[model samples]
Target: MKFVASLSAAAAALGALAMLPTTSAHGPETREEVVKFLDQQATAYHCAPAVAAYTAARKRSWAQKVLGGAPIADQNRFIDGYFEAKGLDGEVVKKGIKELEEEGKRIMACDPVVESKIRNSTCVLAPQSTEGPYYHTEAHPIRSNMAEWQLGLHFEMDVGVIDVETCEPVPNILVDLWHANATGHYAGHPEPAPHLRDEKPAASGLRRGLLSAYPRTNHVDTFLRGALPTDQNGVAHFVSTFPGYYTGRATHVHIKVHNEWSVLPNGSFTSGNLVHTGQFFFDDDLNESIDKLWPYNTNPIIALGRTRTRNWEDSLQIYQDAHDNGYMPTFDVEKIGGVLQDGLVGYITVGVNTSASYKPVWNPNSGRAGGVVEQKPIDKATHEEL
Candidate 1:
């Protein structure tokens, strides 16, 4: 994929651009001027209301209410009130307050026009880091004639836990899953052609039996959303093939977790709350090979790197951290060269139990406690971080 200059640099440039006051509270029309005006409005309001207020109260009297107050004090008070209302304790509230200060500074630095645009629309600077070959086929449909091999791209990943305060992994947690098929396609897309059922007499295909066959085709509702169970060693595995690249993003898998707490209405077990959202990658050779083709070439995030294995480890670590707080893990896959495609593996380890008060509904079949269970309490002998 063609690489754009670093997103951080772009943000820095935007920050610099924000400083140029090309437009006054009232001024001539120019792109720079428009951007400046928007930035100013953003600094004043910090939200859509600020922009609306600036526009409506351009007469200064309203401007004072939107911009003239003791901003730092007001911000502190607002954050305090927010934390209080949210039932956060002193530490969490303090952390949130600090984050707000940082955000406030970023907001203050933005050109009013840029800030206004951000508030008014979903536009923002591009990301500094790569996210994925995420699926975005809502607009066009994949052709059915695409060969199965051409359509399925393999993705593999690992999962684990994190520290709630710093968002880093603790250790030894299992992640499991299933995902969409290749061709950047998923099941239940409203347009159904590749059927997912079996009515004929004994026609079977690989990965197309049981769960695979019940939904029949990858195009039908089977690839992306099954909750897999973890084993005693805190590891889970899936047999999904790779997924194809999509525009603007990289290839990735979506996964949810099931822990000691997850339960179901029928007394069976469900997975734990989701813990991460990340992507897995193949080696550089694989990326280069894929980049030589279409779609993948157009993606901006793909890049050649010498330390792809390191990158893989780093990415997996991040996924584990994201899930530490009981959130599902999401990750991307980069097909590198020379890796074992068939046995591509991912791992995760849980750390300190952050879900102290989180009570999971009990599932008798899953062998977990509590109609609900929390992470804090564990079987001491096992030392399971859960």
Candidate 2:
């Protein structure tokens, strides 16, 4: 909306906003201060129209559906049109590209061995991304009704997979998705009357996240968690509600990519390749709107206290880190607009290796690798895993 003001003037305005005074370390502490701060973020980030972003996202979604794993440029054509049509700020675009370039160079210069190990593992794919705080590989990995949470903004995403080795689209890859509900509670993580998992939104004054202090009943009721395979064009679509944020993280969606995964005779996932893992990000401006919405705002932290859900900064940093290590930032999430209710579409291309033979290492009590990442020896000269 206001953020997308005439692009011709956006360069000057972003320059001005960049020079604005920074907020204190943790962010606005009081409710009134939080509101004022978020309002400022909305203005500064140039909140785009939910309709425009959603529409652009929707068109891109359809294109992905029909074209499947089409080249990124094809999808960008549609995305760029949306930004152009909405008159997106040139400064935002310019700054994003510049940052990407610098990050790219940095990643390219990392130790080849370390970069190899990183890229071979989920850590390198999605910019400091991890797996198994809560993941269901057995029962509900391919589900689509994740929106059953029944609260907060509705969200859907279309993921495109590219084979970095071949520079081509990869099809039939299984994509796993999960995130916290509007209350910052993830499905299967445990909630006694979980919907009422914590303070009533009206009560205010609660703002913790998925830290160990929270219960993990593992109810496995299966909301906001599922998996789908990419079509011929390397695209997998999902249905979900906008995620709620917790302490130390922004609003995000965790995605895992599995190659050679297939539905067995009973329709359960059998083969697993655990190729990629990363999180999708949202526009800071639109997040301000989510802060004021029901349930999401009700998360004790936001309703009663402060907002732990910082915006794009952390994701950008992680992306930079991954790029420095010579890998892509999981995927590129093209945001269409800010309105959370009408729903928006997200698109990203994840690069995966079809020939990877690494076994996943999970969180072993002894600090051993157990999940998607494996412990490997690093060569100092190359700072790479040998």
Candidate 3:
């Protein structure tokens, strides 16, 4: 992995390479550009390995594990020995911290809300929740607008990204999002369940549970699912509708962050390290307000007189996410138009370590992998050099 000497040479080389739909308007358009930026970033931020070690240590400590999240000084102590053990000078980490402090002051002087939202962006090695049953590696198009005429209140999301190790904004990374419709059904999955009662099952013994046997997707609908790249400011904007509640889970949205991924000819992606797999939750008041709307009020679970799960009641996943180390996975939402009937907008800053890696779990029930860590080489539309 050789680094380009200068941005001028990298830009000249990128002039001949093809661009993909996942490229941000202001971000790197080719793999060479991304690699160049990463090479420069690596020189300044060397705390990724140290942060990963601290996260693992926290999981092993019974006291820290019981308390949920540890203090900042305690976490710093855990990583203090890492630099000495790896023979890295401590001045590098100090320099990175000084740079972040300057940026934080500037952002605070500009807008307090922006600075406050990203203040706790720390690296989390684990996923907030398990990738639910409705995930597919192929056929997810790269676009901003994911709403395909689904009847519900409009939802506009602006997701901010930052490297937790250095607290610096991360650009050119892919943010993949998907959620349920107003009727509590996900697109491309028309199978009949307690929520979706229209289509038949793809297999005979497919059941509904986190550990139950799942079935492969039988349809090709990609509504309410899409991917977008972060701009120079490390933000990805998406348009959709507020998701309705499912049988066992609260109203939430699924998200995944892809680093160094390649776009295929079919508009899907492959050969990337999945750095983050998490879910974002909504406030109870907002979910309650949306529940009284027209289409959301007509869910099959409501028709069947079954109780919908709330955030507090969904203890296993939601509780862990809310109290997890350095991760605030809930969105801060507000009314977009004068009334809630028109639309809503939400914002959240996702903290991740770009250098960290995780393997995608294999699900024998569905015959498909859970998330993408890396895959075999293929012909990329961007002509990306893997």
RMSD of each: 20.0, 12.9, 17.4
For candidate 3, the per-residue lDDT at 326 reads 34
Write down the worst ten-residue block by lDDT for model 2.
114-123
Model 3: per-residue lDDT, tens digit, 92-178? Answer: 533434444434333323332332233223333334455666877887788899998788899887776667555445668899999
Q: Pick the candidate with the highest lDDT.
A: 3
Off by over 4 Å in 1: 1-178, 190-220, 260-285, 290-343, 346-386
lDDT of 2 by residue, 70-151 (tens): 4324443442333332222334433433333333222223222211112211111233354535665665556655687467
Better of 1 and 3 by TM-score: 3
lDDT of 1 by residue, 1-386 (tens): 11122345435646565555532211224656444543433322222222122211111221134336323122321212223322223244335435454443344343334432223211111111212222222211111111234333343333333333332223333343333344334554422235533232122321111122222223433334333334332223344454453222233444323233344553234434423323333333444454444543443223422211222223213322332222222221222224434323333232223344333332212212223323464444443454
Q: How many clashes (backbone N, Cα, C below 3 Å) per candidate?
A: 67, 30, 0
Global local distance difference test of model 1: 0.32
Q: Candidates sorted by lDDT, descending order?
A: 3, 2, 1
For all predicted structures, in order, the TM-scores are: 0.32, 0.57, 0.60
